[model samples]
Target chain A: MSAPLIELVDIEKHFGPVIALNGVSVSVKEGECHCLLGDNGAGKSTFIKTMSGVHKPTRGTIRVQGAEVTFNSPRDAMEAGIATVYQDLAMIPLMSVTRNFWMGREPEKRFGPFKMFDFHTANKVTLSEMAKMGIHLRSPDQAVGTLSGGERQTVAIARAVYFGAKVLILDEPTSALGVRQTSNVLATIDKVRKKGIGVVFITHNVRHAMAVGDRFTVLNRGKTLGTAARGEIKAEELQDMMAGGQELAALEGSLGGTI
Target chain B: MAEANQAAAPIKDERVREMSPLRKALIRPELGAICGTIVVFLFFLAIARDSGMFAPEGIINWGTVAAQFAIIAVGACLLMIAGEFDLSVGSMIGFSGIVIALMTVQWGFPAWFGILVAFALALAIGALNGFLVIRTGLPSFIVTLAFLYILRGLTIFISITTTRKTIIGGVREASEGDPIAWLFGGKVFNGLFVWLADLGIVDTFVAGPKAGQPVVEGIPMLMIWALALIVFGHLLLTRTKFGNWIFASGGDAQAARYVGVPVNRVKISMFMFSAFCATVFATCQVMEFGSAAADRGLLKEFEAIISVVIGGALLTGGYGSVIGAALGALIFGVVQQGLFFAGVESSLFRVFLGVILLLAVILNTYIRRMITGER
Candidate 1:
């Protein structure tokens, strides 16, 4: 219906003669959940890194909103409204909820030689934002480490959204979560999509992909096996593709049932 | 239906047991410090009573001494909270004091001008220390240690080269009653120096020549300075964004950077603040003594660090309180001075201090684990 928000054309990455991403192409539209699925050594990490500006694709062009761009640093990506919530969450758990929410960007009031942080404003903003995400925190002064895993992920996602992230890249947001926690994270993703932000959900879970993903791209052996729309592919077909069906079939033939 | 509901609820109840109040309190790391402070206070009170040392005058004297250490310890706490150490604070004090004395005695500068120049010099040295540490990526401990020697050597070299007689030789000598001398060296009433004495609060204890009369007139201006610093330091560490950044930077520098915090700048500024506080203390010492020597504040850095650690600051940084550090300094000063009043050998104070330091480290480690929920 609209031009892709981010398009990776012929992307290639190599690490000292070992190709990590070889001629991979993908496009993510605005307000859509694009799932990148692959087994180990399938270049999923490399592709995400390239998209997040941690690495420059050896030979490819990245276009955002139909404009070609090249990123040399993660900061560059951030400047372009691309924010990544890493697996570690980049949060200080011992810090207060409000402080963690406004870690790098804190509000301040100045009085001549004396300047003070505006904790009042920080608390109000963090609480209201968390409320918008359907999280009712007991106290803004509570340490972040005391929060559940799902709640922490929500905090990170909320921080990115509040800071005007147009494209949110989540790296294994549900990997360490429980079943209910994973569902909660998926709900947050759905909420992000409703707000018209492009989301790149990177995961190895097929059920999770089927839950909120609109498009799926399977990567294998540092290359793309196929890309399909939600309605065009079945969950079992995607799983078989991820496992390299032809290779598995050949191995099964060689092993044949004994007796 | 009733049996099935009870069976399901029992399983859920067993999975999420509520924590007891005692369990919660025991798990808090700061609770240990609170208990330790109470125990230490009771011990001092007991010793004071046993030695007939509970008089108001005795309390005032001990408090005055404690105030001095408390003030510098506040600055040291800030430095430690920011994940840096300033071993040169002691030397910076000596350097600032000497600078002020030389300016007044040798350069014919007014007392006010001397104080300002000394402070500026101290701030510069502090900035330099920060710059060197940040630029070279060296540990602050080593950088400050080198600075300690450099500043100490400079103070000695300057003091040797400038003589009092040589300074006044080339200028028209003013009388002893000149306003500058009066301002710098004047006494309040008949016995106490004006700046070094507290009049309003201490006046109540002053007795008019009766048996067991209070001997001391008032608290020192140095003590007042220490109190003010403690308040300001508390505000800086707890209520400000800079304070939060300091915590974040010390907790995890890489994480702080990823979030776009200027970690290096926060650290360098902390070093500068430590030096600035040292200079302030040095100026007050010089004014109180009416003279400055190359060794005026020797080994004070160790006392400040010890005070901070004892007050509940973690060496690894991330968490600390300026007020806690001031209290820690108070504990040190009281024990040292109280030992004298109790007829204990002065050298024994060192042994007591060492034991206190060891206990503080053990307590800090335990509390840290508790706070982090680590086994």
Candidate 2:
């Protein structure tokens, strides 16, 4: 209630002739799991990009830690304690897990014009950080590609939190995961939320959103339907809102006609 | 800061064999190249049948030529790991040799000065190649292909204009008394060869009346440079943050950028490093050959790329080792020289090379997929 960790007021995003997001507003509070629920092509990606400084809002204000701030790049957002773990995770499949965890920010030790990567620190940090996320890697030297989908997602999440993320944005982290893997990712989210970091879990699955989400924001066609707390909103109503209120009826009618 | 609350139950039912130490070593990208080296060496040894090809002399014979290809191949491997290509390397060899020849032979500049000038010019060209590729977002293949022609033509035009002949000679004589040329060209230690000669290790000096004089000479300096480059390349690729950046940039440039890697800078440096190596080869070659021709170093770029590919680097980018490239060069040299030792036709060498490349690539791809658990 006392100024959320990150607040977006009437956020709008556009790409030339396309309006991907319009007057959408959402805020994530400290130590809360706020799910951004939207279907495919519902501008979830564009919205997160805006939040993570990948894109500037066409019209709206973004407040972080109670201050209006503008982000020029992803680095800017990261510096301002916002980290995004995209679905792809942005990890090198061939590289070791430690390498991927510290991709852009590798530790280095220098001696007389010769600088070397500090594998000792990297491996130590990677193993411990991943363990803290409820996912213990066998070895830091193991390739990230070898890890399961849920584990990879957890690695990304852990890396974000390790690198200082007051607000974490996960873009469809469980979309491609299997049932067990999905639950594993949910467990990771729960662990992260307990650490007092604000989480923006982007997903389209109603059950997944309802599982750990403390607050839900439903978006469709570049607009937000509404935001509701877990106790306030009914599961049936949230499902209808995600389907665009009447979009599902229209789809059902079309299928009925074909039948 | 919280401890892992690992689930009590095992999740995966699939049978994944516990990886062993030996299995880990076998999956290394360089494994194929190492095996290929041994196979090729043994094949040559069997065919040579009591020839010196089994001895250090044979190693020297094949190694000298391998060194030439290895120098350039190391650069190709690095650039490939960084997810790019520079087809202009072969032409860069010609260009650098010509520039150095002109400056030292025609302009009478000190050989060291000429070498420095050529180095700077090569780095500049490399930087330009990188700039164009990065800024325009064009495939390096197309960009470097254009440079290949541009540099080749420039070399020819310059060669014809400066000297009446396309070939420039007397570089060795021109470089006489210049310490830099001597450092690059002159051999340091004669004791090992002298000892070998005394022990009847190598053939008695084959030519001239003085040839019977137990004529052990200093080692070829280019071989030293080649060996040095191997150690340097291996360390840089494995021990440095720059190496990690190269792999990251090559693996997925977009993803690397998303995580805040300086992908553009990494790529551009790789291009420059590739060209710089070509120039280094030229410097050593001109010092060794005593001459430079506009037509020098034709098709060397393909040879370098082939070596890198044989070393188990993916053409698509990312995931490679320079030590693998070194061994790949070794495989090439052994097979090539072994043919000569066995009295086989040289043209068949191309067929053998083609087969080896195909086999090596398939093996590397299969191994990588197995390791990554990708289909």
Candidate 3:
């Protein structure tokens, strides 16, 4: 419908002699969820890392808003409005939610000649932003470790959204979550997609991907199998593709079809 | 099902469950240190009250000693919170004092210049310590332990080579009128003490050339430096963005790096701060003693670490308080001096350090469990 907000064309990544991602391509349009489905060792991590600028692809053209760009570091990608909420979440457990929310870009207030972190602004922003994601915080001073797994996810997602991320990359946001937490995260994804922000939801779970993904791209052993629009793919078909069609069929036969 | 209701009305905010205030306070990093300080003060007051331990002059004695520990403990606390250690701190103190003495007394340099040189050299070594750890990906404990021996050997060798002895004197003469030296060695609030002595509010010398002057002269610059460092360290850790970075760097270094925090720089800077603190302590010691000895500050690094641990800092890092560390130092100074005042064996102070450190570690482990919610 509209020009892709960000595009990765023919991306290739190599770790010395081993090729991690081989000529994989994916793109995200505005307000669209592009799900990248891959099983273990499918290079999903390498692809996302390249997209988020943690690793420089050996071959690829990255276009952001129709302009060819290169990111040398995660900071560069963030400056280009690409924020990645990694699997580990990159949050300090012992720190307060407010502190972790404003970790890198802390707001400062000046008193005469001295400057200090503006806790008032930070606390207020943290509480409201978290609430917007349906997480009511008792105190911004509470340690992040005290929050449930689901609430921590909301904090991370809300943080990326609040920081003006045009493209949000979620690395298995639902992988560690229970069913209820996973649904909450899905709802958060729905909210983000509605706000005109492009989302790259990376996961191996076909059902979770099908829940919010508008376009699905299946990555098999560092190469894209195919891209399908919402109605073009079914859950069973995607799950079969994710498990590697023939290989899984062969394993099923060897295991006497118990699987 | 329930998720739909949660999305619709935020029912009761189950996620933000309330805990009792006492349960909350129990998890704080400073709770153990605060309680320890109170217990120590009460114990000393009960036994040493009639022994002049609470007298102003006697208070100054322990207070100055506490300040010494606090100065180094502040640096150690911050460094430990940043997830590193500096075993070289004691050697750095000895080396710094020797450098100042060698430069000012033997080489006939100005006291201010010598102090600057000592600080510069110690910081460089400190930076080197951080660099080696970062580059080698080794634990800071090992890197700094190596530096401990290197710096101690260098200090002794240099002093012996230059002056044929491991001790240097004439620092007081060389630094007599220097303003920078006075900042470390001189007393403050002299006029206030004088006025108080004149008004009979403070005790005065009864029979000496200094009769009518306050027996407690004024607050030593060492104590002021200690207090300043404690306040500065506390504020920097709690009220600044850099403080957050420090906590993140130690808490989860890889996570911090992924989040765009400069973990290497934060850690390296902490090592340098530790060296800076040791140098300050050394300068004050040399100035106060009017000499520098290569054997000075022996085992002081362990003392500083013990103070931080007693203050409730986790050995694994990412959690601590500077005020807590200062209070831990206060407990040390009081117990060390109070032992003598209460007619106990002074050597029992070492026994006290071992006992208190163990007790603090156990208490900290419990608090950590409370915060982390681990069994």
lDDT per residue for candidate 3 within B283-319, as digits (tens), equals 9999999999999999999989999999988778888
i-RMSD of model 1 (Å, 1 decimal):
9.3
Residue B326 Cα positional deviation in candidate 2, in Å, after optimal superposition = 0.6
Per-residue C-alpha lDDT of model 2 across residues B41-76, encoded as one tens digit per residue: 778767796776776667777888898889999989
Leading candidate by TM-score: 3
Pairs that collide in candidate 1 are: none
Which CAPRI quality tier does the interface of model 2 achieve? medium
Top lDDT model: 3
In candidate 1, position B302 carries an lDDT of 89
Q: Native-vs-model 3 lDDT? A: 0.89
Q: What shift in Å separates residue B360 of candidate 3 from its native position after superposition? A: 2.5
- Which is superior by TM-score, 1 or 2? 2
DockQ list for all candidates? 0.29, 0.52, 0.39
Q: lDDT: which is higher, 1 or 2?
A: 2
Model 2 bad stretches (over 4 Å): A111-113, A250-259, B1-16, B206-209, B212-216
How much is the lDDT of residue B308 in candidate 3? 95
Per-residue error at A219 for model 2, in Å?
A: 1.7
